[model samples]
Target: SQQGEEDPQALSIQEGENATMNCSYKTSINNLQWYRQNSGRGLVHLILIRSNEREKHSGRLRVTLDTSKKSSSLLITASRAADTASYFCAPRDEKLTFGTGTRLTIIP
Candidate 1:
């Protein structure tokens, strides 16, 4: 399990605003992925950035990876109340390991 710790355990924001969360890992990884979990449900894959890639974006979500620092960040643009959930980063070589996630609350 290469997944490490994530920072700022939680966050709150207003709708139409942006939310950013960061993650840090301790070992070498092939790629990093971000996932979103609603309340007590299963996680859904949001985005993935490879070690060779610096940044990636999907819809309103953006991801950045800094391999030298063993850290990554996820940014959600124009957030909505429905976007409120827990976000996690999984730094993986072969298997995915999830760290403590950041809980985001979006005020409508």
Candidate 2:
């Protein structure tokens, strides 16, 4: 609970369908990140949106905005330590729709 609260925590959709998740936050944020997982890995970066940005798109992933509390530290630490190329940000909107068939790779 250090960041945005995602709704319908568990979601199920068909292979070609879109999966939408809502994240509502109290305060404003700078940027937001969307992560893709492959059942094995934790968070695989899918997209990034900045505070000044209103929206973003990637293959089948769309991000608006969300509110996160203490996750800033976790995001920053992970980026610098693991060098896992993880992504983070504060979304401006409250909805996220991920395309189940899309794939993305990030290197930092």
Candidate 2 segments exceeding 4 Å error: 66-108
lDDT of 2 at 101: 25
Candidate 1 residue pairs in backbone clash: none
Candidate 1 residues lying further than 4 Å off, grouped into runs, are: none
Clashing pairs in 2: 31-89, 31-90, 32-89, 32-90, 65-91, 65-92, 65-93, 66-91
Where is model 1 poorest over a 10-residue stretch in terms of lDDT?
Answer: 1-10
Score every model by TM-score.
0.96, 0.53
Which prediction has the highest TM-score against the true structure?
1
Residue 30's lDDT within candidate 2 is 54
lDDT of 1: 0.91
Global CA lDDT computed for model 2:
0.42
Residue-level lDDT for 58 in candidate 1: 94
- Model 1, 4-108: lDDT tens digits are 577779999999999999999988999998999998899999998999999999999999999999999999999999999999999988887888899999999
Q: Mind giving the per-residue lDDT tens digits that candidate 2 earns over 2-48?
A: 24544544444333334455544455655655554554566666567
Give the TM-score (vs. native) of candidate 2.
Answer: 0.53
